[model samples]
Target: MAEAELPDPPSQGIIGYLKMVGPGVILGSLAIGSGEWILFPALVVKYGPYLLWAALLSAIIQAVVAVESLKYTIYCGQPIHKAYQRLPPNPMTWAWIWTLLIIIPVVWPGWAMSSATALAALQLGRLPGPQDSYLVLAWGLFALTVGLLVIHVGRKIQRTLEIVSWPLLILLLATIIVGVAFSASPSAWATVLSGFAGFLRPRLGFPPRDQINWFIVSAAIAYIPAGFGFNLFMSSYARDKGWGMGSKIGYISGLIGGRKVELKTEEMPFNVDDPENLRRWRGWLKVARLDSYLFFSGLTMITLILTTVMTYSLLVPRGLAPTGFKVAAAQAKALSEVLGGLAWIIVLLGGFWVLFDNQWGLMDSVGRTVADNFWFASERIKRWAKNDPRRIYYLTVYLIYGVAVIIMVLSTVFKIARPYELAATGAVLGLFALMIAPILQLIVSNRILPKPLRPGIVSNIIMIIGAVFYGFLITAMCLQMFAGITI
Candidate 1:
């Protein structure tokens, strides 16, 4: 607390570089998995790629919100949770709403995915009929074990995330890039154009039996949550890194902190008075947002179009329904006439890579954020988990998540619920989460920000508008889901 000496911003040594890269790697992991990999594909198969725009739009909105989060962190040094507390606390009527806002949605994916994964493993070769019940038991066990490990060895948990994320991303991107290119036939191109139209020109009403239906049109709303889970998660990350806001019109962005993506809340905070450091951090901010580039944005938009085309071509019109190895088998069989199992490799690797890794990112970010939250707890408790406090806590979080996954997975065993239903519930939760993120960012950026480093006119305007747009999406989706609609 003395001017004479201050703990330096996180040491930028070899260790510092690794520490920084961790979050992005984690984010990368989560992005590919549950959201992009699993959810997007599932949506595409059912709806036939018309909602691809949803993905691009969601990513763009998320990037803007993410930058805002970084700005707050670099300036205010408060993670998103505390940042909300910085916002005026909610009235009694909204208290439970605010508390449940992040927690339920946040935990849903983990539980859902755990259940899915366990069920998946069974399909992949685990157990038999009434599969989900057995899976749920396993899911609960995994959550418990991971949680306990976190309570003991939190630091190991951190390293483990980095270990898991980077490789997953590299493998995933490589696979997808290849598969998408290879899959682009002239016929596929035609389908993409038409599907893009379908997505863009939505007919908002009831459809005939098994025609587009309410469930299908509801994609407009569902897409938001499908892509925006990390808005606030990353917001907390930015706050923790000590970022501040700015007029962002001319900032050409790129990836700065790949191997060096993070800074403890204080380390990255902006200091306008320190011109050199400010420039360095700003430069990194732009890079960290490579997905925001005009060209990249266009690519994402087109990707949406193409995905929809492919889905409708294969599914709705043809009446070809496939899942698991069956889906891959069909694709491979089609390609075998042209190039053999090469297509199979591309199908499996690319399709599965993103979803698998994305989980790592979500779990890792939350684990780290939680670790940072009460990292100062008595060493004795930490010792009980193990000597490595941070790792212990992260493992504990994963385990805490295991319970819900188990419950849902067991539904299959008990014949109480179905996979599609679980997917529907998860999709709804994810969408509502999108609606909640912007306001959280606004609070963190506005109030938590140092006055001098606050967001300027233009950026703030865009942010306010963004928040309202998502709020609208959230409201529509909630109404639809509550009313027993399914798309």
Candidate 2:
């Protein structure tokens, strides 16, 4: 691997940094998927706002995890997975482990199935029923096809996500704001505000032992901003968007317009010992931190709170809890009480986009993660693809699409599990990866980067806390699932 001289960071004030923000915006949009649109609302409707503190905790911890992971990418201009390949006794071991870890949780297609139900409800002018399984399946396939077309036509995958995400993000937030303004009562607002402090609420701090559904709760936590291995993809986006040392490396281009672009597999390390390089490194780090806090953290928290409050206000009063494929439909039905028939259109349309965007973003990340790992892990694959990462990426994308289609058919036709159920199951299964990712990030950043470029004490402590917290949750969930015990 050749070492590249560190270029001076883009000279910019706060305004310049704000204008440069793209990856976090895309990430924030991705974060708003099944968790916000489906899972969080379901949790709120069932337990009221008492569980909201978990959302708060998740956001803060995941923010630390995301920023620390980016340290490797910003310093090396490669996805963090590339750094993971440098870990331990055998590089191939982590590569194969992470590929499986990324694929298993994301292959469920829950978001697409749920989005299809929303579309089906929109077409039918009512909540979809069991009889509508085929209808929903058709819509699910349609959604996946459309998502494929959009990604294929784009010049760059990250650029496409940014362009689509910005408007979708604005629309989702605007829709939620309008719904909350018209529908949420003053008392509902108070309850939601206090729920952020739910840890302090006596006997209500955590779900009671009997009411605890470990899988669903784990899913909810996983999705507080984004869940499972998805947050780790933030480094990939930042790299593709040319943040920090990523400016020197190439990105994964799309199939049509991006056919000629080649992703550099060679590691490009900056000269961290240079004073100028260190100075530029600080500036770049600042940009990443601001982007994560403002777009990823800020947008996610705002959306989560507003959506939860609005759903709690609307559904709890009607004794409704969204579950199954009816997740979006149930919310639309509740909104109909106040917004009239248009409520169905409003709720379902917003829900579809929320979920569709999630599906689109998640598929891309999963494709990228898998392709990168395989490309790095196997010289045979590298030779087979002829060194073009895009070939592997697109192939992975289409293959995942095929698998998702199959899963959607089975789930819809045979009633294997509800959309939310599938989402929760996928999330819970990914918890081990989630638990290990931060610890790996901590090791990679501390061990590889120069002292001045290493994570500070606070970051180290926060990452440790995040790892331990997730490890504890994973243990409790395993005990409950296997030992017939609850904690």
Best by TM-score: 2
> What are the lDDT figures for the candidates, one per model?
0.46, 0.81
TM-score of each: 0.68, 0.95
lDDT of 1 at 298: 33
lDDT of 2: 0.81
What is the TM-score of candidate 2? 0.95
For residue 45, model 2's alpha carbon misses the true position, in angstroms, by 2.0
Candidate 1 scores a C-alpha RMSD against the true structure in Å of 7.8
Off by over 4 Å in 1: 1-22, 45-48, 90-99, 106-159, 190-228, 235-281, 291-317, 321-346, 349-352, 368-399, 447-452, 456-458, 483-487
Model 2 Cα lDDT, one tens digit per residue, 59-160: 877787778777778888888888888877666787779878878888898888888888888888887778888998899899888887777756678888
